[model samples]
Target: MGRIIAIANQKGGVGKTTTAINLSACLAEAGKKVLTIDLDPQGNTTSGLGIDKDELENTVYELMLDECSIKESMKKTDIENLTIIPANVNLAGAEIELLDVKEKEYVLKNSVDYIQDDFDFIIIDCPPSLNMLTINSMTTANTILVPIQCEYYALEGLSQLMHTIHLVQERLNPNLEMEGVVFTMYDARTNLSTQVVENVKNNLDTTIYQTIIPRNIRLAEAPSHGLPITLYDSKSAGAESYRDLAREVINRKDV
Candidate 1:
């Protein structure tokens, strides 16, 4: 079965979507069949991969609320071997609607079950909240990839996130595991960034990924252009770092 990894952090601006988009692109470029599931209502992942959100007929919203099959919602992207289950604004209501529904926690997990064996990886870009949407993402995921910004408050909301993960492991998906933590927007020129890195390493049990994504204009520009950094500026530091992250993920999985 394919590994389902939820790129999650209850904190925004932590490079969650950036890691999801670029890493999925690099994995596809490396000849791995990858599927990206946009669980965030913001639809940033959908647009980042070059999929027009307004034009999407079926999305993760439909799959979750309307009981639509994940297969029908899957859209092929510009990158070969990369597919996406786009998320639109409609998903914003799922949080409230799923609250009292029976077996609501497993909706996303059940949707992905049918296609679990079709790809090497399923990366879900979770919403930046500990709401129902995030719970669904957690329930469906086999591992969680956390992206921590190299800043002062980077570790502030982490305790709450870990507590939620523990709850999910105990009540939802016991097999769920932590993949690793990635430091993003790292600036070596700043002592604070270096200190944040050491702090995260000293606190978390998970290994820190070696590939630290530097703050790059190219990475920020690619999202507005609706393209992954790999396709927009392959030679940029942002693109190369994501490619390295992909390799590191593969290598660690092999071990």
Candidate 2:
């Protein structure tokens, strides 16, 4: 079975979507069949893979509403082994629509269950809130990959996220675990970044990936060009860090 990992962070601007896009691309580059599902209504992950969100026929919205089969919604990306279930603004209303469905939280899990074995890994990019969409992602995922930016307030809202995860583990998916925590937007020149890293290591019980994503211009620029850093500028530090992170993830026994 493919390991379903949700790239989530309740805090926005934490590099959650960036990690979701690049990590999956890097994993595909490593010869693993990877599928990324954009659970965020913003559809940034969909566009980051070079797919036009406005041009999509079938999206994650239709899949969630039982309007289309999962296979019909899957879009092959420019990357060889990477595929995506694109999402759009239409998905923003799925939460309200799902309220009337039976086993509403598991709708996503049930929808994608049959297709799990086709990929080596399935990564989900969750919204910045702990809403119904995020719950569905957590319920379906085997583990969650958290991307924390190197900042003073990094640990501010983490407790609530952990509480949500604890609730999911207790009532929804008992097998759910934290895949790993990754530090993003690190500035080596700043002592604050170093302090944030030390603080995170001291505070969290989860394993942290050693490869730190620096504050690279290429990383921020790649998304605007509708491409992953690997495709946009492979030699950049952003691409190198994500590739290293992929290797670490592949080697992890816990993943």
Candidate with top TM-score is 2
Alpha carbon deviation, residue 218, candidate 2 (Å): 0.3
TM-score of each: 0.98, 0.99
Candidate 2 lDDT over 39-96, as tens digits, reads 9999999999999999999999999999999999999999999999999999999999
Which regions of candidate 1 deviate over 4 angstroms? none
Give the per-residue lDDT of model 1 (tens digit) for 133-228: 899889999888999999999999999999999999999999888988999999989999999999999998886789899988999899999999
Question: Clashing residue pairs, candidate 1?
Answer: none
lDDT for 181 in candidate 1 is 94
Model 2 stretches with alpha carbons more than 4 Å out: none
The C-alpha RMSD of each candidate to the native structure, in angstroms, is: 1.1, 0.6
Q: Go through the candidates in order and give each one's C-alpha lDDT.
A: 0.92, 0.95
